[model samples]
Target: MIQQLLINEIDLHVQAILQESGVERPSTLKILTEHPAHLEHGDYSSNIAMQLAKIVRRAPLQIAQDLQARMEKNGRVQGLFRKVEAVQPGFLNFYLAWDTWAQRAEQAAQSLGGIGKNTKVLIEHTSINPNKAAHVGHLRNSCIGDSLSRMLAHAGYEVEVHNYIDDLGNQLADTVVGILHTRTEESFDRFGDFCWETYAKINQAYKSQPELAEQRAVVLHALESGKSNLAWMGNLVAERIVREQLEEMKQFGIQYDVLVWESSIVNAGFWDTTFELLSQTDMFHKVADGKLAGCWVLKNREDEAVAELDNAEHQGDKVLVRSNGILTYTAKDIAYHLWKFGLLSNDFVYKKWGAGLWSTSSQGSKKKIGHADMVINVIDHRQQYPQEMVKLALQVLGYEEAASQLKHVSYGVVSLSPDTAAGLGIAISDGKSSYAMSGRQGIGIKVADLLDHMESVIEAKRSKKTGISSRTIAAASIRYYLLKYQLQTEVILDLEQATEVTGNTGVYLLYAYSRANSILDKAKKDARVLHLEPDFNVSLLEEQEYPLLRHIAYWPETLAAATQQLAPSLICHYAFELAALFNHFYSACPVLKGSESSIRHRLWITQIYKQTLQQALELLGMPTPNRL
Candidate 1:
C-alpha cells in the first residue's frame, strides 16, 4: 500500500511538470519503484526523471529537480515521505516518513489476493505409471503440483487438482506379464517393490527372447481391451500400487481432488467421441501410400503443407493412431484436455474415493468437475514435444482461446549424488560425482525409503526427541530441498545437505519461526514488558528493525508474484530471506529489555514476522512447527 502511494504521488507530479513545460506527456511514462539495497539509499528509488529526459528535451538532473519541487508542495507526498531527493544523473529517492511507517505497523492495509476470485484452474500432475514405487523425481513433481494447488486456492481461485493414472500403459502391461510368468523369488512386505524388481527382469528377458517381446504386445492389447483375466490382474496390481503411492504422498501432506484413470477414458468411449470430431477438421488426415500409411495423424501446422504429407517426421506432424488401430499417448492427452475444458459433450462417471475426493470410474453417478477456465500440466522437461502436440490439437479444432489458456509447466528431473546412489545399494564402481536415477533398473530411492532415511538422519542429529515428531521435519527438509532450485534445473539429491539446519533449508526457516514464537510467548507471560497501549512511538524502532518491518508488509506482493509465475520456488526464496532478516534484527535490537515503546514495537515486529513466514511455509507445503 505504501509503495503504490509513493509511486502515484511521484507520477502525478511528473505530469504537472510536463504540462507546465508545454510538453505532451507520454502515455507510457511508467513509474517503477524498488526497495533500495541499503538504508542509506532511502526506502524506495525510481528513475522517472531519466525516462522523461528525451520527451521534455531537458537534462535529467534539471527535470528531477522540477519533479522534486512539485512533489514537496503536495500534501499527500509530504505526509508519506520525509524528503524526496533528486540524485545525480536523475534518480528520485523517497524516504518514508516516521508517521507513515508507524501507521503501517499499527494497521497495514495491503492485500492483493482474491484477484482470481471467480475463475477455475485445473492442474494435472504426478501421473506416474501405477506399476512401481514412486521415485524422487515423482516426489518433486508432487511437491510442485501440491504447492501450486495450495497457493491458487489461497488466492481465491476454484482450484481442481487431478492425478492422471495411466493404468493401461505399457509399463503396467510389462508388470502384469512379469507377475504371471515368474514365481516369487523372495518374500516382500510391499507389493510395489516386488513389481519393481520383476519389471527389470521382464525387460531383460524380452531382449534375449524375441517371442517374449511379442507376448508383451499381446498383454498391452489385453490391458487396453479391459475384459480378460489378464486385464483384471493388471487392474488389481495398478490399484494396489496407486494406494501405496498415495500413502507415501500423505507423509508430505499432498492430496488431490480427483484421480483420473486412463482406462476410464478408454472404456467410456470418450476418445472415440473426440476422434469423430477431429475427423471433420482439415488438420486431421489419413496418410496414404507411404511409411505413415494407414494411420490417422494431425499436421504440425496448417501453413507447413508439403508436397508429400505422408512424411510426418520431416514436417514435425504427429501420428495419433498406428496402422493396427492403437491410439498414442498424445491422442489420449488431447481427449482428456477436451474434457477438462468442457469442449466434449460427454462426461466421465465419478465415484467417491474418500472424503472430498473423487475418482473417475467406468460406471457411477455424476458429479460436477473438470470444467475450468485454465488448465496446467506439470510434467518433466522430457515431455515437451508431446505436451505441445496436445496444445496444437486444441488450436486445430478452432478453440484458439482455450488453447491459449493451456499451460505446460516443465521441470527438470531429479538425480542422485554418487554417495547417495551407493547408499541406495547401487554399485558405484566407476568414480562419478552424480548419477541419473532409473526406476526400471531399481537404481533410484523409493519415496517411502527416502522419508524413512531422512527421518532417521534427523533423529540421529538431535540430542533428544522433542514434542514435535521427526516426520514433520523430514517432510519439510525434502520439500524445501526440492523446491529451492529454480524450475528446469536438474537437482542432485544430497541427504546430508538437505538435513542441515543451519543452511537455507526448510528446517532452518522453521527454527527461525520457533525462535520468534518463543520471544512472543515469553513477552505475553510478563505483562510488564510491553505496554498494550494503542499507540507506540515508531522512532523507538532501531535501524535494523526497518528491514524486518518492510519485509513483513510485503507478503501480499510476494504471493502475487509467485502465483503469477506458477513457481513455488519464489515463495521459498522469500521465506528464507525473511527468516534471515528477522535473525539479524533480533541480534541487533533488544525486544524484552528496552523502553516500553521500543519493547512494544519490537514485539509487534516479531509477531508479524512469525505470521508472514508461516504463510510462506504453508504455501510451499512445509509444516510449521512451533518448536524443533
Candidate 2:
C-alpha cells in the first residue's frame, strides 16, 4: 500500500517536471532504494539523478537539488513530502507525510477480501512408512507440511493435504515376521505398540539369525501366494499400526484428505498395470547377472551408482522383478506414485473409509477421484535419488504432463542430537533425545508421546492465565508450538525451550495477540466502534505505533514468499518478528490510558495488531490464547 502511494507520487512529479521544461522525454520515473536505511532517508529515493547528470554533463548533486526544487515549486508533491532535501552525494530524500506510515495498518486491514483471496494449493507431507510408528523425525515432516498447507489456505488458497502411506515394504515383511513368530505376551500388552516393538526386534534379528530371515521370506512367499491365514494376519497388523499413527498425528492437527496406502495399490493390481505399461514402452530390461537373471531391471543411473557406494554390498542394481517373481519395494512404489500422478492406466475402487468423520478439506465428504492436476510427494531427502528415478521413469513412459507436475518436496533429515545417525537406536550420548525412524529397536519416540509431552507443558502454562478456560488455551498452544520452525532445518526440540510461554517461540507470539485482544475487549466496553476506513487519519499515529503497523504491512509479502519458496519456515520467522515488534510497541505505548478520542484510536490500532497476529498464528497452525 505504501509502495503504491510512492509510485503514484513519483509519476505525478515526473509528469509535472516534463510539462514545465517542455521536454518530450517519453520515459517512466522509477523509485530505487538499496535498503531500509535508504527508505528512512527518503519516502522514495532515486539514483537516476546520477545517470541523468552523466548524460547532461552536470554535477549529480546540483541536478538532484534542482529537481527537488522544481518538483516542490510546481506543487506536484505538495502535501506528500513533509520536506524534500538533497543530502550530500546527490541523494534526494523525501520525509513522507508521517501520517502515510501510520495509515498503512488500517489501510491494509481494510483491503477487500483482506485475508486470503480464493487460491488453492495441495500439500503432501509426512508420508512415513506405515510399518513403523511416527517419530520425532516424522514430527518435522508433518509440522512443515501442515504449516505450509494452512498458510497457503489462509492466504486464500484452496489447499488440499495428502499423506501417502507406504504400507507395503520390506518393513511390512518384517512386521509380518514379528506378528507370526517374534511377538511376546509383554509386547502384545498394547495392540499397535506390540507390533511396533516386535517389528524393530524382528528387523535386528534378521541380521544374526538366518532362520529368522528365512521365516521372513516364507511369510513373503505366503503373502504373494494369497494364503488366507497369512494374508489376514498381515492385513490386521498393518491396519492396527496405521490407525495408531493416524490417531497420534491427529492430536497435532496433521491430517490428510485420503490415506493413499501402498497395500491398496497392491489390491487394485496397480503394479501389474504399471509393469505392462513399462514393458510396452520398453522401459524395463531383463537383467543378465549371477543372482538377478530372469529378473526385470532398470539400469542404474550414474547418480544412483554413487548413492549405493555407502550401502555397496546390499544396494546395487535393483531388481524390480525378482527371479522368484515377487515385485520389489521400488517397483511397488513406482506403481503407486504413477497412480498418484494419474500416469498409471489403472485405478482403485476407493471405498469411503469415513473421510468426512474428521476434518473438512478439499476432498470434503466425497469419494476419491482418479486424477489431480498436480502431485506433491513429501519424503525425506535420503530417498531423493529414488524419487528422481520415479520422475524419470514416468517421463520415459510418455506421461510427460503427469511427470512435470510430480513434485518431490524432499526435506533434509532431522538429526537433533550430536550422536544422531539415521534410523532409531540408542545414541550412547544423549540416549535418544529426538525420535529416530527405525522399527527394529522400538527406540524412536512415538507421535503420541511427543503430543502428550507438549500438551502437558501447554496445560501447565494455560493454568497460569487469568480466567481463560483450560480447553481453549490448551487447544491454542498445541497448534502454536507445533509449527514454530521451518521444515528443512534440524530442530533440537529441547522440551524445556519449546515449552516456554515467552521468548522467540509460538507461545510468545500467541501471548502478544491474546494480550492485544484482551486489551481491546476491555476498550470495546467504552470506546466508539471504529472501523478501518480508507480515510483513517494516519498522521494521528505516534512513534510507538509505527513498528506495529510496519509488521502488519508485511502479510501479502509473507504469503507470496511462503508459497513461492515452498517453505513454511518463512511464515514462522515472520510471525516471531511480528510478535517481537508488537511486544516492543506494547511495552512502550499507552493505548488504554490516553485521552478520550486519542485513546479510542490507539485501541483501534491495538485491534489491528490483535487481528493480524491472530490470522498469522492461525496460518502457522498455532493457537491464539485469550490470556497469558
Candidate 3:
C-alpha cells in the first residue's frame, strides 16, 4: 500500500513535467515500480522516463532529470521520499523516508484486509479419479489448488472448492472388473491401496490376455446403466475408495465443498438436457460418411490456423458422442460446466457429505449449489484439449462471458529424481532427466507412503527440545516443496532435498519464524530490551536492516502480482527471499546486546519480519511451527 502511494506521487510529477516540456503525455503510461537489484540505487525505481524517451524525442537521462526536478518541488513527494534521484540513462530512483515508511509498513502489516471484490469463485481441483490410491503427482495438484484457494479466500473472495468425482469412467470400471475377478488373501487396511495394485494388475493382464478388455466393457456398461447389481458393486467400490482418498487428502489439509459424481450427471438426465440444447445449435452435427461416421462432433474453435486450413480433410474436430451413441467425457464435462455457470435449467439433488460438505445424489435433498460467477478447473496439462472444448462449447451456446470466465489452471506433471527413483526401487532409462510416475504402471510413490517417509526422516532430525510433531513438520515441508516451483516447471521430488532444514525449504522458513520467536521471547525478559517502545529511532537501523524492511513493505505488491498472474510461485519466491534477508540481518546485527535505541529498533524489525513471514507461509498453506 505504501509502495502504491509512492508510485501515485511519482506518476503525477511525471505528468506535470511532460506538460511543461511541451510533450503530450501518452494516453497509456505504465507507471511501474520495482526495487533496484542493488540497494544503493534506491528502495524503489521507476523507468517511465525511459519509456517516454522515444515519444518525447529526448535522451532518457534528460527526461529523468526533468522529472526528478519537478518531483523534488512537489510537497507530497517530500513526505514520502527522502531524495528523488535521476540515475544513469533513464531510471528515477526514489529513496524512502525511513521513519515514514517504517511507521506505514508497521501499520499496513497490522491492518491487512482482504483484496477481493466479493465475486464468487468456484475452483474445482484434486478431482482424482476414485479408482486408485493418490500418488505424488496428485499431491502436486492438491497442494497448488489448496494454496490458491487459501490465497483467494485471504483476498476476500467467496470461494467454493469442488472435487469432481469421475466415478463412472473407464478407470473405475477397470478397477471394478478387477475386484470382481481377482481373489486375494492379503489383508488390506485401505481399500484404495488394494484397488491401486489391482488396477495395475488388470491393465498388465489386458496387455497379454486381451480377453480381459471385454470384461472392462461389460463393467463400463454396467456403470452407465446405474441400476444393475454390477453397477451397485462399482458404486460401492468407488464410495469406499473415495473415502480412503479423502482421508489421505485430509492429512495434507485439503477439503472440498462438494463431491460431484459423474454418475449423478448421467442418471439425473443433465446430459440429456445438454444434448437437447446442443441439438438446437449448429455446433454439433453427425458425420454422415467418414472415419467418424455417425459420431456427433463439435467444431474446433480454438486454433484459427487449423480452422482456416483450406483443405476440409485436414480440419480437426472434437468428438462429442461416439457412433455407438455413448457420450464422450468432453460431452459430460460440457454439461457439468453448463451447470457450473448456471446456464442449464437442470440442477442436482444434494446430500450432506462431511460435517459441512455436500455431494450430488440421484435421490436426495434438493439444493442449489453449482452456480458461480467464475469457474477455475485445476486439471493437469494433459487435459488442455478437453478443457478447450468445454470452453468452446460455452462460447458456441452464446455464453461468451461465461466462456471467458472459465479458466483452466493447468500444471505440469511431477516426476522423481534419479536418486529418489533408485531409492524407491524404480529403474529409470539412461537418457531421461526424470522418471515420470504412472498410476497404471504402478510406478508412482503413493501419497501416504511419501508422507510416512518424510515424517520418519523429519523425526530423526528433530530435537527433543522442539514441541512440533513430526507429522506437522513433514506436512509443512512437503506442501512447501510442492508449491515452490512455477506451474510449468517440472518438479522432480528429491527426498533428500525436500526434508533438508536449510536453503529455501519450508523447514527453513519455519525455523526462521521460530528463531524470531526465540529472539523476541528472550528480549521480553532482558532489562535492556524489555522496556523498548514501538517508537524507536529509525536512524539506528543498519544497512542490512533497510533491505529487510523494504522487502517487508513489498508484501502487498507481491501478493497483487501473484494474484493477477495466477501464480503462487511469486509468493513462494518472496517468502524465501525475506527469510534469507532476515537470516543475513541476524548474522550481521546484534539484537539484545546493542545500544538501547538500536536494540529496540532491531527487535521491532524482527517482529515485523516474523509476522510477514507467517502470513506468506499461510498463503502457501504451510503451518509455521513455533519451534523447529
Where does model 2 exceed 4 Å of error? 1-39, 42-121, 183-190, 222-227, 280-284, 289-295, 299-319, 355-370, 399-401, 416-437, 461-482, 526-536
List model 3 lDDT by residue over 1-628, tens digit each.
7677777887887777677778887778788888898988988898988898887788999988988887777754747788889988789998888787766675574333556666788999999998989998898899888888888887777889999999889999989878877666777668888988888888888888788899988988889998799899988988988888888888888889899999889887888898898888877778787577788888875532213333233346777887899988889999999999998888899989888799998878987687888898888888887898898889888999999999998898899889888876776668577898777777778888888988998888877735678888788888888888999888988878877867888888888888898898888887766778645476686777878888988898888777767788899999999999999999999777757777778888888898899888888888776676
Worst lDDT run of 10 residues, candidate 1, spans 306-315
What residue pairs are clashing in model 3?
Answer: none
Per-residue lDDT for 95 in model 3? 82
lDDT score, candidate 3, position 104: 67
- Given candidate 2, what's the lDDT at residue 280? 76
What does candidate 3 score on TM? 0.94
RMSD of each: 2.8, 6.2, 2.9
From the highest TM-score down, the ranking of the candidates is: 3, 1, 2
Return the clash pairs for model 1, or none: none
Candidate 2 all-Cα RMSD: 6.2
lDDT value, residue 61 of candidate 1: 92
**Alpha-carbon deviation at 369 in model 2, angstroms:** 2.2
Per-residue lDDT over 323-440 for candidate 2, one digit per residue giving the tens place of the 0 to 100 score: 7787877788789777665666667654454554232122334344535666666677777767776776787787788778777776766543434343233555645555444446
Q: State residue 232's C-alpha deviation in candidate 3, in Å.
A: 1.7
Native-to-model Cα distance after best TM-score fit, residue 561 in candidate 3, in Å: 1.0
